[model samples]
Target: MNVAKALLSIMTLTSLTACTALPAGPSRSTGPLVIQEQGSFAAGGKVVSTPGTYDNNNPAAQGQTFHGDHLYAFYQIPQNPKPLPIVMLHGAYQSARSWETTSDGREGFQTLFLRRGFPVYLVDQPRRGRAGNSTVAATIEPTPFDQLFFDQFRIGKWPDYFDNVQFDRKPETLDQFFRSVTPNTGPYDADVISDAMAALFDKTGPGILFSHSQAGGPGWLTAIKSENVKGIVALEPGSGFIFPEGELPREMPSAAGTLTPEAVPLADFERLTRVPIVIYYGDNFPVEPTTERGQDNWRVRLAMARLWVDAINKHGGDAQLVHLPEIGIRGNTHFLMSDLNNVQIANLVSEFLEEKDLD
Candidate 1:
């Protein structure tokens, strides 16, 4: 009886110790655990007025100028993460701030993911937002504000801002969105954008690239350039991939000369087979689009996404296509991330990552 009692005590102690020793990680059961670190960084050189000249000025305008088109990133780390961190890329005419706050003022995807114990790297694309301006981006003219974004995003009818669905519905939400739009010159170099993003990959090991709208081009380009790109989540990746000839976007160069098909081939998306991808679209997408260029872009983008998926699968890559409404999630515009029930959408993304073992 004494020996039996002693053995029981030893077993109980071992069990308790095992429980205490467990690391703080997200489980299929409990959610995100311990957070280890969190911070922000510039993906490229910073403009310093006082790079070398700090005579009387401690920090203000020492007369240093930083180059533009450099990517900037901020990250939050959980003590235990299921997969590598996620690198979020915003679309054209916007900054990394889009992922941080909604037009309505609610928390954005950054908060949602951070709460889930996933490390998130939010980016301000080169020549946009905090990234400042650069020689490369200077040559292009300006992308005027017309119905290009308003109608194309399906936010509402052209020239009408208040009619469509919105999160805050308050007059302020509308103000907030328009305020968030960043300036751009002509067609910004997607290759330079990708290079800046690749530099980010170098700083922070391998991870996922989550891109929205116009950001998809650079997102795909970055995946091609960086081996560290484990997977990609392209949301509303422009026009339905387009409904024209069931064709996909041609590859533009990341640098001066194209080396081989393995590098930056024009139409060969097959090279991305090793990486997993998910192309997601929101409600009101043009399934049967018109021939009109603007109204028809969605059809092409949609077709682009589907074909990309098929092409990837055929080439041994894993890619999936998802429509918000088809899954019973409806009324989302191009700004789906800031939509009313973005939490639900975030859940879907999380589930996809887990399903693919990305997190």
Candidate 2:
């Protein structure tokens, strides 16, 4: 009996070991992750100087001269590139790093799309990130606003997370998310940003423009200014919807504040009709106005976005607003591109590009 029990125990241990062993064959590989070219450039800014002569004795003196108002773009072209490259622009309080990696250290949209054979250009807009020089100066107070942004970003409440939210919700991930917030070296000026982005398009020729949050307004203006913007993918653009000069929507009121729409000339508005545009929003928006400031903020924006889409389609333009929840993809936060299900979201975008013939 003892000999039989020993044999059975040995057999069970062997089975467990086999189960934990690593596979022997070669792992899957869809060709090499090769890059034919990778480089960076400063685009669309002018040189500015103080009104004084050079002071070699004191370089810190008021006679400083430097280039300001330019944007920084980093490009990665694959060995075999797609027809149209993708130009990525971040939103308020962010830099090009926004698209580089997720808060939890997962692969971001930048690399994901790059692997799909598309050239990727990541931009640090004027007066932010690498392009820190600005024509105008602004005071940057070290205000403790992480909690406020935490709520505003729809990640969760200050001290708690929403049920089954797509964010990782780990302490380290939250820390990384907060640390990623960058301060602008200059004030937020839509005209300056649009001008710089227009210059980027001018350099890159025709490419798909991907903008998030605040950059949406400038993205529209850039497309209007430059014919090189062939398509657009906007993620949760919180503001900057442009209407015809005489057809602006009324201001939307919410617990957060009032949401307003910008206006553009009819000719400029018509420029957007030339390209396909898709706007994506994540979950957790209240059906009606709520006392929760964070939730209410996006509620108004989503409403405004629907109107904006209608206006675009009315003008013979191809524009769509996709609420992920309505389509059965639930629990995503405002930063859908960086959420846990970002790959799934990226697949949806890939489908859009293929459908529009922009791939």
Candidate 3:
């Protein structure tokens, strides 16, 4: 009986060792993962000779012009143009090119939209992208308020500071730098962009508006002000109403030390409901509570949209909401527009445009 027991124990140990061994598979390179990396293409569908450098001589680049006071933008007019154009707006601290690249070589929003036969225009908003502080030196130095926030939050350093922050020659905290930079004239900036688009439309034609994150607020404002915008696809728009009499929840902490009564009033969004609007929310995206009260900010955002939608529908306007699943991202956060799964987002927008006959 003892001999039989010993044999069984040895068999069990062998099985455990077998399970611990790594599964056999194809060998992987030690370097970074390279997915679908491809060469850049010009607006005319011709492959540019230089990979990274913008070719000013290209007709596609020459066709568009930038306003003297406004920032320059990159555009790709399709070789085979579709009915309407599409203007893409990047989020905070990102360039017009932010939607186009991934670490694994996946095609960006520009490539996807171009392939769909639509002319794509990417803009770098004021105080951001190439138009904003482009130097590495501009990011490191923080302002007094930034330091104060850091001290309050016990944050030692900013994440991705090396890549995103612009340090000045003298000492300044992040808050000071942010305050020093001119606010882009709020909704007026959006009006100016819309005017620029109107000129583009006069030359090219009317188009669809696509905005991500914080830019969504301005894009919505722009659409409200413009007559040419056919439709809008807003991805994760920030807080909408900022007016003193607006319908913000009483629970939300007001910006700075001001009460809700003291805050600046945002324009009435319900009145501007001529075009169809689609609001997209990512289920897996994590949003930080903007206030110290730990309110569910994203929920508030959706609620605000719902309020606007209800108001719009009452007045006979078309508005829709889309919520994406959480499966695509491994550890994704609020910046869902820049994730690898953004291709799915592109596909969704394409489908919406086609269905609405706006493409």
**Lowest lDDT 10-mer window, candidate 1?**
253-262
Question: Whose lDDT is greatest here?
Answer: 2
| Cα lDDT tens digits for candidate 2, 85-144 | 999999999999889889999889888888888899999999999999998988998989
Which of the predicted structures, 2 or 3, would earn the higher lDDT when compared with the native? 2
**What local distance difference test score does each model get?**
0.71, 0.89, 0.52
Q: Give the C-alpha lDDT of model 1.
A: 0.71
- Candidate 2, residue 110: lDDT: 87
Candidate 1 has a TM-score of 0.74
- Candidate with more favorable, higher TM-score: 2 or 3: 2
Candidate 1 stretches with Cα past 4 Å from truth are 1-35, 44-66, 137-148, 159-166, 185-187, 239-268, 291-295
Model 3 / residue 5 / CA error / Å: 82
Clash pairs detected, candidate 2: none
State TM-scores per candidate.
0.74, 0.89, 0.57
- After superposition, which runs of candidate 3 have C-alpha atoms over 4 Å from their true positions? 1-69, 132-203, 241-271, 285-295, 326-332
